[model samples]
Target: MVGALAVLAVVLILWQILPGALNVPRYVIPPLSEVLVALTDPVAFPRYVQNAAATMTEVGLGLLIGVVLGLALAITLTQLPRVYGIVFPYIVAIESIPKVAIAPLFVIWFGFGLPSKVVVVVLLAFFPVLVNTIHGLRNVDRDLINLFRVNGASRMQIQVRLMIPAAMPQIFSGLELAVANAMIGAIVAEFVGAQQGLGVLILQAQGRMETPAVFALLIILSALGIFLNLFVRLARKWIITWERT
Candidate 1:
């Protein structure tokens, strides 16, 4: 932690001094001090809160819905190989399309609303969770599965008691990736069309040439991503306590 803080301190120092030392225009890259000031600017702070709230809502909704859908689909695929063979290719094809490229289409379909942003986030998050969960479920120990069968465990009992627990680690990894993707999806969708969000704030700052504000917003986003990643880590520890063994 100390080393990380030291590195961050050095970066901040450089950010504060480099533009002046190298004669870079403030409009191009404002000093870190200026960006900090923008972060605390009383007039803009409320707006920041409002926009951030919108983005957070989209992220939360999308993450919950995406994870649930992914888990359901993974379980279905695992239990029904024929269905998996039929639909997995279609899923891959949809996931193959660039999410950014589809943002505008989502806006057209969902109409510049929060629903569009949430849908984009769902798309971004769904595949990772599905793939990871499926991988974990499919790779369970055959010996253990046979043992369960020999002991007269029902298929549902084996799945609930063994498979899902075993899959938690991979599922958590997917959740971490999904968190980042969800953030990106929300921002990208907002950029395409939204009345409010950090993305909209960024577009506004860019339009007004408020470079410091833009940098500040980016910093806010990075911090949010970090918080979410940490949250997932904590949740993983709680849910997968046996992992420590």
Candidate 2:
């Protein structure tokens, strides 16, 4: 962890110095010090941080919905072969549509607000969860399934006791990747519509040539994304260890 922080510190220190050394305009790309100021300054921070909060809210809600729906769908696919056959093509179709193209329609249906952003995040987040979860569950041992049957476990019992536990490691790994994608979807959704958020703030900043603010907003989003992934990873590690012998 110290090594990683050292690398990040070196990168940021270079970022702080490099642009000014190159004599670049703040309009095109601001120096890291200026961007840091925009991020740390009270007035700009509150205004800019709202977008990050908005996107975070959307991501949280969207991730909840995505995990539930993905797990349910994975359960169906792993156990109900007929339903899986029927639904696989549609899942692919839904995932194939470009999110940017779909964002406007989401706005039209759900309005230019949090709901629309959640929809986009869920769409972007679900595929990873579904694919990984289905893969994990299907890869379960046939001997284990027979063991559950010999013990007279019901279908639900077998699924709840066996499949979910066995699949957790893969599911957690997929979820970490999904969290990053969800953040991206939330940000992109905000960019397409809505009055407040980092997306709108970024648009306004770009219009006014406030490149420092844009970079600051991006930094905040990246920080939030890292926080989420790291938290989940630590939680997953503990859970995996606890479940093992």
Candidate 3:
């Protein structure tokens, strides 16, 4: 995979350079050399890291909140039949609303700060977790549940010993997706209104028509995405420690 990436990098470098070396208009595209040239400078690089950190901080907090609330809601909806009848529809309705459409309201209400970005991230990230967790819990192996009952386990014991453990993998599956969504949502929230962050830097670069800087921000953001994915994969692997069996 590393070799493949290196090959692709070489190809892209060649692809980007071939045109500009022949004097392709700058308006058409900047060369890979130009992109690399810009990348060499340290001044523009740290801002990308700072902004990425800001966005990641918001995403981490929001994903944590979203996962907790989603799990709580999913368990409630599954365990109590009566609660589902009253609450599930509301959950659907709230989840159906466009997060971006209401993100400005979050900013207006929570102010243009981390709180608002975190709120947006949670709103966008929770649905996947909620739906997946509910599905996982409600679709437990009937035999295992029955075995627990036959053993005279109470509801809490059934939940703790059987249901939650069984559902954990699926829950983490949703959580992985939610983490990515949370990051995207945080960046988008910042793009709409933020004083610092990659999204803000992108907006600034866009306003200035700084193509190399824009590309630089994009590269850094992509790296952040890769790291987030790797971390989540590691977390999921740890959470499902029984999967090896």
Candidate 4:
């Protein structure tokens, strides 16, 4: 932690000084101090908070729905291999489309509102979990499965007591990827169309050529992404304790 802090300090120092030293244009890349001042502006700070909250709401709702749907579909496919074989190709084809390219379509369908942003996030977040869960469920130990069968364990019982638990690592891996994708989706959707969000705020700042404000908003986004990824890691540690042992 101390080492990380030191590295951050060095980066901040460089950010504060390098522009002036290199005779770089402030409009192109503002100094760190300017960005900090922008963030701490009394009038703008409140607006930033409100917009960030709106974006977070979209991310949280979309993530919950996506994860639940991914898990359900994965479980269903695992239990019915024939269905998986039939639909897997179609699923892959859908996943192949660029999510950013579809953000405009979502806005057209759902309007320039919260629903569009949430739909984009769900599209970006679900596939990783579905793929990882399917891989984990199908790759379980044959011996362990037979042992459960010999003990007369019902299919549902084995799924709950064995398959899901065994799949936790893979699920968590997917979740980490999903969190980052969720952030991207929210921003992209907001970029395409939204009443309020960090992405919208960034666009406004860019339009006015508020270089410091744009840099400040980008910093906030980077910090948010790191915090979310860290949260996922902590949750993985807590839930997958057996993996560590």
Error of 1 at 109 (Å): 0.9
Model 4, position 21: C-alpha lDDT score? 96
Worst 10 residues of 4 by lDDT: 91-100
What are the per-residue Cα lDDT tens digits for candidate 3 across 123-158?
Answer: 878888998898899889999999999999999999
TM-score of each: 0.97, 0.92, 0.90, 0.97
lDDT of 1 by residue, 137-174 (tens): 99899999999999999989999999999899999989
Give candidates' CA RMSD values in order: 1.2, 2.1, 2.3, 1.2
**Cα-based lDDT for every prediction:** 0.93, 0.85, 0.83, 0.93
Our tally of clashes for model 2 stands at 2
Q: What is the lDDT of residue 75 in candidate 4?
A: 97
Is 3 or 4 the stronger prediction by lDDT?
4
TM-score of 3: 0.90
Q: Candidate 2 on 12-51: residue-level lDDT in tens?
A: 8888788789887778777788888888988777776666
| Cand. 3 Cα-lDDT | 0.83
Better of 3 and 4 by TM-score: 4
Enumerate residue pairs that collide in model 3. Answer: none
Model 4, 1-245: lDDT tens digits are 99999999999999999999999999998999999999999999999999999999999999999999999999999999899999999888987888678999989999999999999898889988898899899988999999999999999999999999999999998899889999999998999989999999999999999999999899899899999999999999998888854
